[model samples]
Target: MLLPTTLILLASLVQAATLTLKNSRFNITSKDATELRAEPLSVTEKLSSPLKLDRTDILRLTFQVVEKDNGNNVQPHQAFLRFYDETTDEEGIQPVRVSNTGKGKFELNMAKPPTSLPPTGSAPLRVSLLIGSFVHSPLKVELFDLHVPASHPPAQHTEEASYHPLPPLGHTFRPEQKLPPRIISASFTGLALAPWLVPLVLWGKVAPSTPRLFSPHILPFVTTLALFEGLLFWYWIDLRLGQVLLYGGILALPTVFAGKHALASIGERRLGLARK
Candidate 1:
């Protein structure tokens, strides 16, 4: 009889230990349907309740919960906090017993700090609240705790350090639609066929003094016409609009180059003046 009793007690202890070891939880069922609030207001990380701490530091937290539907129904609840630095995870809290406060008010304190210095950092220290009576197993109970300062005992190197990577910025992304490759292939083909089409297609040239990229008058007109026609064609054309396309596309690259050079030249002039 004594040996069987010992085995049963050992099994119960093991089950309790397993429950305490669990760090993540999300159930927030309330016994009393009242307004309950968790402090620090971040809703960041969570863990399950009835959690045991290998070690715990002193923690302090306060709650100010009023009725969500009416101002007159102001009822305060109490909770206990328990943290084991030996068990560290600050993602969130899980409630074993939510809304365990029996009366309209209550308070609680844990036995020790939940963690060592390196584990507790500056996070809201977790606490488990055992509101109302410890007896009857309190079927009507409310529980919640605030982030108190976890007293992490000091040691070597830096305590409470964490790492996370920052997301990159800007649109340097390219789709693998073969658009660029096709465009490049077409460009090379155009260049290869340029000598053959020069006299046959673009049979004229502006004066020698006129810059090729910014040929005083015609380049701007040609560039603008090319843009207008290209846009129109892209929007509505079912087949290639050769005359309008050549008119516009030829000037597109040159117009852009001229504009860039203009900006560069102006910047250089301003920089020179500033230096002087």
Candidate 2:
């Protein structure tokens, strides 16, 4: 058992080997297929001078991942090229494609710049390569500083001004709603109340008899109707619609019974008069 365990540990240690790059180089070409610069990349050392790119230039980088112990080619799980703008604290990550045999290649065409390229300014961008694998140790290489032309300003939205804070809401409410003069108000009130005087004048002139006006059954119905009117007036003044509805519902039962009793009593009196 001890021997098997020792062998298994040794195998794991060998499987978790460190990764390195080989045959790494970068080349820059102009739009007319003219070679501007070509140099081999050293994994241990960064380039002394920054690489400059024009608007119509193409840059290509090629490398191969290998084991540090036996120099065997390896395809890592993840590989990426990173462009970072230190001054702006902005970074862009671009994936690097690697073949099964571990040959990785990346191309950047300046004529049609990729979205993965960070927004460039006057300062140069720091370029680096990253490799990660589950069975092997990770590797990071500082490649070179890249100088790209300043990018065009981002487009502004048409309604961008709406996003800004509005000028401190100058509210012009209906100027404190001044009441009308007391004389004018009183005149309107008198005009509104003028119709009530007609019934009083008619009553005085006709003097009609109402023998059952104060009868117990009739009185209850009349009082309930008056209460309904009062409820409506109270709603207009201070009470809410919910309160008025609740009170009216409670008064409805008594009103219904009183109205039925008064109607039955009148029917009985008419039948008795017919019999007479």
Query: How does each model score on lDDT?
Result: 0.41, 0.91
Clashes of each: 36, 0
Per-residue lDDT over 104-150 for candidate 2, one digit per residue giving the tens place of the 0 to 100 score = 99999999988998878898999999999988888999999999999
Poorly placed runs, candidate 2 (over 4 Å): 1-7, 31-40, 44-48, 86-92, 99-103, 112-123, 153-180, 209-276
Clashing pairs in 2: none
Point out where model 1 deviates above 4 Å: 1-79, 83-119, 122-124, 132-135, 139-276
The TM-score of candidate 2 is 0.62
| Model 1 CA lDDT for position 1 | 92
Predicted structure 1: lDDT: 0.41
For residue 75, give model 2's deviation from the true position in Å. 3.7
lDDT of 1 at 144: 31
TM-score of every prediction relative to native? 0.17, 0.62
